[model samples]
Target: MVRELLLAHGNGGEETWTIIKDLFLKYLDDPILSKLEDAAVVPLEGHIAVTTDAFTVSPIFFRGGDIGKLAVCGTVNDLAAMGARPMYMTVSFILEEGMSLEDLETVVRSMGDTARSLGVRVVAGDTKVVPKGTADGVFIVSTGIGRVVYPGLSSHNVRDGDIIIVTGTIGDHGACILAAREGLDFETHLESDCAPLWDMVEALLKEGVEIHAMRDPTRGGLSAVLHEWARASGVSFVVDEQSVPVREEVRGLCEFLGLEPYHLACEGRMVLAVAEESAERVLEILRQHPLGTNAAVIGRAQKGKPQVLLRTAYGTHRFLEPPMGELLPRIC
Candidate 1:
């Protein structure tokens, strides 16, 4: 069954790696970051962070990025969230047989180009080929190692009154994927805003800002990441709906699909908790970056039930909960 499933491009739900409780993770605990965060905190006597991720976004190629670019940016962003300076990386590929060599080369070149853009290096890698149709066209697993610029930091540092700032417009990446996949039409030439955010993070850190927590809003989107933080920190978050950034096109699409963009996945957005005094400075630094030009201070952590509340523009309030199921399957 495994072999037969691997030979088909889109098999019946057999490609996911929900086996996260396997033995490999059990051995890497404690100082090695077996905690299973996006990146591991490799305390090199000095401060360093290591993170790894696997990209299985269906379609492989998208409007703004390909698998290769996603691999590099995804790993880099993990380090950024941890207040680290990304230095090196290792990439591995699991390719399905029958995928064109030309397509693979394009992906590889894209990976290299993006790494250079971030001033990081792809120092190592491995490759394996599965029978065509058995795997997605390609699967990439990337590991990144970096030096933590902030020694006294962890997502646990977040607290009440700290400001919540988002890097840029939400739902762009998710909308781009939907448009590309369903061949939807849109007025603006919408594209996935996938890119490395280490530089932006580094700039914010350099300003001597005290950040409580940081996370790249990926798989589960803003609500997912925020709820995770709320549960971990035992605090409530009140987000102003009007303050959250969502493009008009994306809003229209979400309304049509009966989906909430806040629950949609984002590849290029980061949620940050900053000390109230430094929130403006952080926003200034984020705005200086091309990717974070739409950055905004959306809300603040509060002392209440550990839940996310959304204050609608019409004076109505609603709770934004974690996404119940796959909003868009195979969507990164």
Candidate 2:
């Protein structure tokens, strides 16, 4: 019986099979993954959306979710932003020696649970264990394949007069990770917003909303997305700074830390550009979903030089620069 991960488990010998058959299969078993082939065989049709991500969040276990959950959600959200339906995923684990089997199992369970909830199948995977101190406790690399249902979603699709909508309050994940890593204490609670977003995207598609472009505001956060959209679409975004929702706790923490909320990461939130006529319908559909209760239109696209302009409540405007130089390292 395996008590702890060993280097032999990655040597492609009996120990590797034992771990694959006993540990991984026990949790992520499915017809595709059950094949145990060199590569996953998946049938596809229509446009395809493929994405990959690696999760090395410093604290693997955080308030709202763990690295495993982040792994699934990150990949799924990438596809969802492109108007695709997430279908299959392959997850690889890099484990540190002497790591507790219980902790490994806990992470695996969370991965399985998140995948199942999203109707995404684990099609293949790999595992490798390194000597302790050579690596963090664990790191997850996930590759996802999705079928695109709505076509023409692109950063270049944003047009003048388009409205920008954010799915929810920003920076929850970044703040949670920062607070946990720094061991900060506050009366208000902060939790990561790591979650699957396909359901919310699908709702918008079903309503026939005219989605011009979409993205999940992750590492570089809302600032990064807005800057990218402005540059790619060759337009300027005039944002109402006050209309951009920031949770009181998050705002307080950002102020104390001298961090801009727009520059912080959000795992579950999405930034979307849609036709002005479809904006309200899209907002109504988003609010109907539990994940989008806090959705709001924060800005409008305009014909101008490529830049994001933030107008504060005081009628002052400034260029919101693109995030640079690793705001939060190892933040998923």
Worst window of 10 by summed lDDT in candidate 2: 179-188
TM-score of 1: 0.85
Q: Report lDDT (Cα) of residue 237, candidate 2.
A: 93
TM-score of 2: 0.97
Name the Cα RMSD for model 1. Answer: 8.6
Question: In order, how many clashes per candidate?
Answer: 7, 0
lDDT of 2 at 173: 95
Write candidate 1's Cα lDDT for 134-234 as tens digits: 78778899999888887666666779998999999888888888877777844456678788888888878888888888998887789888898888888
List of clashing residue pairs for candidate 1: 6-133, 6-134, 7-133, 7-134, 8-133, 39-51, 40-50
- Top candidate on lDDT is 2
Task: Tell me the whole-model lDDT of each prediction, alpha carbons only.
Answer: 0.78, 0.92
